[model samples]
Target: MKKTTFILPILVIAVVAALSAVFIVDEREKALVLRFGRVVAVQEQPGLAFKVPLIDEVVTYDDRILSLEVGPLEVTPEDDRRLVVDAFARYRITDLRQFREAVGASGIPGAENRLDKIMRAQTREVLGSVSSNDILSSDRAALMLRIRNGAISEASGFGIEVIDVRLKRTDLPQANLDATFARMRAEREREAADEIARGEEAAQRVRAQADRTEVELVSEAEREAEVIRGEADAERNAIFAEAYGRDPEFFEFYRSLTAYARSMQDGNSSMVLSPDSEFFNYLKSSTGGVSTR
Candidate 1:
């Protein structure tokens, strides 16, 4: 019973020691085993790992790609125009030992700080040489490439791999915004005025054309009507001549009747003519007679 009790206690102690000495490394993590504050082993694969129970410690770091947002950095370009530029970067730690050495106790934060500084410095260096207009231009793609290359080169020293770098936005300074907006408003007003003037000019042309067309149409119709009236009058005169040749007395009577009808056509007509007036001759003698006067 004494032996069994002693062995049971030993087994319990062994189990406790084993539990303390064993650690796990996830697939998403990389671990470092340190002995007396000195790194002794690196475990990069997933599964169970062993370490000295009391004298060793493990530190795990994310072995995946990380993201960083560098800045809304104020930059002055070649044109001496100030702009607010923001940027983002993707980075990964390629060398764990160097990363640990470079950052020490601060870990990811320290590394991020380094990346931000390098990225910002490169951004300034590349963008500062270009005009503000260039930054806003289509050549921005090339400019970003230059900045990214610079950052990648500079960050390599800290065992960091720059996967990509990009400028998020570049904006004018607040002080410049008001002036720009005012200028834009003025330009738009000028363009609108030009458009209005052109429209008015076109409208005038259309009105002039319509007036000319109306005058031409009325003049043509009047000319055609005058021609028709002249032909009808000639025909009527010929008919009267034929009637006169056929019967002189009847023609005289018809002419007298027509003259009398003209003199009395108005509903309220009044005449103060002498009876000898030629106008009254036809009325005075319906049978037709030449006026003696």
Candidate 2:
């Protein structure tokens, strides 16, 4: 009776322990319980979980964020610019049953491989329609959104939810880089030449305007000087006419005296005169009142 009691208690305790075994799932983890190599329950909550012991196997998967970097791919844009683009993505396993069925034994590597293929194909298809400048500039965000949407949609079968997609780097081949740089340099030089030519043209226009102004000013000054000179000459002639009209006889005598003085200024000069010449009549009148010595 004592042996039966001990054995029965031991069996009851074992059965209770086996039927009442509980699992503590973390907030960031999902638990998969398999019975006899077949998944029987999926626990996604952050509490205790009961399962049949010895027959149930538990698999814990992280429900946190996961990152996968796709390998570099060569893409040609609409402008014929070839680039090696490296990209990455963030995702999480949203469906454990589907993940287990699709991933099988390969785990995350299998998921990453499948993602890489899809990413490469979608990247090529999306970027191929855009020019290189657009890809490098404003269209990048739209392109990434499209890639994320397409990846999530396609990866739905694999039980993966894509959160975001980002491009890490875009590289140009060495030969293409050299060509692009050369073209850029040529364009800059052409623009510089055009600016220089425009500046020279503007300078020429300014100089021409200045020269025209200078010519106009000089012509105006010359005209003004000629008018003043004419006015001065007319004024002098009017004064002379007024004086001469007032005393014609005295003016004639003064003019004759001025002529005689200018003519006698040369020392070796001879004069011919009549005895009753007007020049001698003045001298005779002065001598009659004074006496010749």
Candidate 3:
């Protein structure tokens, strides 16, 4: 029993030592071996890694891409329009040694904090240089690209590579929303009014043209009727002249009879004339004496 206890303790100690001397790194991670607070070796590949037991430390970092979210930060664009912007960034640690050196004991958290500052600064700088319309437009891919480039350049010192930066949301402040809506409403109202005025102007032009056409038609018809009446009068006078040239006596008798019929149309019609006047010529017979009726 005494020998078994002594050998069992030694075996347990050896197993513990062996377990502490090595570690298994996942494929998604990179391990750094530090001895006495100094980096002694770096394991970028996966699988088993060796280290001195109780004398060395292993730090693992993610080798895949990581994401960082930036603020709903307020920015004033070139047009002096203020906007609230929400953004995010995608980054990866490129050099693990440089990363450790740059971030020191704080590790990923320290690197992220610094990266957040860089992203915020770049976001403000790039967005502020342009107009709010540009930021709110669908073509804002260029602006996002500019922010990413600036962030990548600044973050390089910390062994970070910024893949992309995107603005998730951009909007006017609650205080400005009502004002912008009112302005848009007024603009639409003005445009509607302009369209109505143009329609009325076109209607007036059409109405004036119709009125002119109506007047011209009436005047032309009156002119044509006057021409027809004048032609009729001329033809009747020519017929009268031809009848008078054919027979003077009959024409004179017919004229006298027509005058007598017109004068005696009313039963009470009377005339004052000398009997010897030629007005009684029709009453005289073929002889020189007066004829009884």
Ordered list by lDDT, greatest first = 3, 1, 2
Each prediction's Cα lDDT score?
0.87, 0.85, 0.90
Stretches off by above 4 angstroms in model 2 are 1-21, 34-41, 50-57, 65-73, 83-88, 104-106, 130-146, 163-182, 241-293
- Range of the 10 consecutive residues with the lowest summed lDDT in candidate 2: 284-293
List TM-scores for all candidates, in order: 0.74, 0.62, 0.65
lDDT per residue for candidate 1 within 159-214, as digits (tens), equals 78998888888998777888889999999999999999999999999999999999
Worst 10 residues of 3 by lDDT: 284-293
Top-lDDT structure, candidate number: 3
Over 1-293, each residue of candidate 2 has an lDDT whose tens digit, in order, gives 99998999899989788666877899989988988767899999988998887678888888998998888889999988899899999999999899888987687788889988988988998889988887777448999999899898999898999999998888887788899899999999999999999999999999999999999999999999999999999998897788779766555656666776787796847888798987654457653333233
TM-score of 2: 0.62
Using TM-score as the yardstick, the better of models 2 and 3 is 3
Q: At residue 50, what lDDT does model 2 achieve?
A: 85
